[model samples]
Target: MSDHFLMFVPTDPTWQPTKADAERAVELFKSIAPNAQTIEAIFTDDVEFHHPCENWSGVDCAACGADLEDWFYETTDKVYRENHFADLSVTTPCCGLHTSLNDLNFVWPAAFGRFALESMRPGLDTNEEQEKAIAACLGSDLRKVWIHL
Candidate 1:
């Protein structure tokens, strides 16, 4: 059986909200996903990758528009080797330009962040207005990811 999850993360991977702010954001999310089996905020000591699991199409370099699957994986391997994505920096193999992994052009939505507000088996999808409102409440632009595992 697959477990499904919906998560929101800051566009800026390093951003961390205060406990109060997280609670407020959770409350706002709860209003939208009232039927979620579980809804809560998670804070990690270091940034973590949030991908769309089976929905992943691939990622590309934002600058040169080159397929970046191999580069992204190898880079992620190195980044997580020490501090688990303490750094998201990357140099595109095709363009040779510096950028963060979080800035890559993901075919499907994904994010890397130290904080997340997530719902398990939520059985719901959010609209643009709801997403924007939640982002405003969190004081950060967000990336929404749907996961199945």
Candidate 2:
């Protein structure tokens, strides 16, 4: 089975939380999801993209149903050393089409010191009440993204 995570990010993409903010967010997450863990938000130039697929599987071109193995290989020189959160775009060799890596389906493990909370099982939807609670705790508007890995 794949793991699912819920990331609480600021409504503004460029906003980075301080250590105290991270701690408060952790507490807020823990109150809602007892198993929540806090990751500090780190500043990065690249925009983070998340894939919603299970276990990195099911990544195929939209125009043509082709696997992304070759596309991934051709796009990156150092495959193993590449940061999973880096900004990327995939040009489908099959159809000669291009798409943002973020637009593609994939699970993104929230990193770079961002306050991320994870739930291992699927279908654990965070209701509006819980979201409001978290927002109140953090004292800011937040956006939630689901990542299935």
Candidate 3:
């Protein structure tokens, strides 16, 4: 059969998704998990890497995304500047597997390692607890947990 893939990205915060960031994320994901038939990622707000060295205040305002109508500045002699800014949003992602549970467990641990623990928290003092936590993260039929962020 053909390859299967799964990806879960955060709902778009802004109305726009840039080509460069999407391409970059896809490339990064491929380099790490090549056999992945399904890949998911959370959509996060665009990060501004550096400040533009230009005189265009409008450009800076757009890049930072400040809404002027939301903010106003007043000075002497009845001078008022209406500043508009951009709004920021957040996105979170998760992925699913179409392979056997064992295969998924193997690949996921190796690929995630430390980061996995960071994402998945539990009191893994023994095998029973470890399995339980894994099931919870995977939303298996073992048990249900109400986790708070």
Top TM-score model: 1
Stretches of candidate 1 off by over 4 Å are none
lDDT of each: 0.90, 0.53, 0.25
Question: What RMSD value applies to candidate 3?
Answer: 21.1
Instruction: Compute the lDDT for candidate 3.
Output: 0.25
User: What is the Cα-based TM-score of model 3?
Assistant: 0.22
Ranked by TM-score, the better of candidates 1 and 3 is: 1
Better of 1 and 3 by lDDT: 1
Question: Looking at candidate 3, what is the lDDT of residue 17?
Answer: 31
Q: In model 3, where do residues sit more than 4 Å from their true spots?
A: 1-4, 37-149
lDDT of 1 by residue, 6-51 (tens): 9999989999888888899899988888898999999998788997
- The TM-scores, one per candidate, come to 0.95, 0.49, 0.22
TM-score of candidate 1 to 2 decimals:
0.95
lDDT at residue 26 of model 1 (Cα atoms): 91
Better of 2 and 3 by TM-score: 2
The segments of candidate 2 whose C-alpha lies over 4 angstroms from its true place after superposition are 35-46, 54-123
